[model samples]
Target: MKARIYVTLKEGVLDPAGKAVVGGVHALGYSEVSEVRIGKFFEMELKDSSDGERIREMCGQLLANPVIEDFRIELGNS
Candidate 1:
């Protein structure tokens, strides 16, 4: 089984890296690009018995910052 985690900044949080990327894109003549936000992606191989609750615990405890970040989990047999 596989677990996928996506961690992203909450709305209204400052993202300097994302902002820098936006500026870089516009400097490359892609002025149409307006915004860019950065996030984290994690892929883990878990035992078949691993449950969503356990995966969520990992996110809440270490994988994501509960104060400024939100996470989503996806589980699959692949």
Candidate 2:
């Protein structure tokens, strides 16, 4: 089984890397681009796809910052 995780900053949190990318995009003549938010994507292989609780624990403990960032998990057959 395969598990995919997406981690992103909360709505009010500031993202410096995203801001830098937006600046670069504008400089390249894409003035219509307004904002960009950066995030993390993780893929893992799991022995038991039904183990959602353990995956959530892993995310809360290490994968994402619970205070400033939110994460979503997607599980699918490999």
Candidate 3:
């Protein structure tokens, strides 16, 4: 099984990288792109597909910063 995790900043958190990207887009004349946010994506191969708790634990423990970030997990066949 493949477990994919998406890590993103929580609401109300400061995102300098996101701001820089948005500014750069505007500078490049893409004014239509008014907002930009950055995040992380992780993929892991698991021996047991049913062991979802392990994946969740990994995300909570290391994959994402709990204080300022949130993560979503998706499971599927590799």
Best by TM-score: 1
Model 3, stretches more than 4 Å misplaced? none
Positional deviation of 16 in candidate 2, in angstroms? 1.1
Q: Assess every candidate by TM-score.
A: 0.96, 0.92, 0.92
Scored against the true structure, residue 11 in model 3 reaches a CA lDDT of: 90
What digit string (tens of lDDT, one per residue) describes model 2 on residues 1-78? 888999999999999999999999999999998999999999989897368888889998999999999999998886
Superposed by TM-score, candidate 3 places the C-alpha of residue 43 at a distance from the truth, in angstroms, of: 1.4
**After best superposition, candidate 3 residue 26: deviation in angstroms?**
0.9
CA lDDT, candidate 2, residue 6: 99
Could you give the C-alpha RMSD of every candidate to the true structure, in order shown?
0.7, 1.2, 1.2
Worst 10 residues of 3 by lDDT: 46-55
Q: Write the per-residue lDDT of candidate 3 for residues 1-78, one digit (tens) a residue.
A: 889999999999988999999999999999999777799999888887368987799789998999999999999996
Model 2 TM: 0.92
Instruction: Between candidates 2 and 3, name the one with more favorable TM-score.
Output: 2
Q: All candidates' lDDT scores? A: 0.94, 0.93, 0.90
Each candidate's clash count: 0, 0, 0
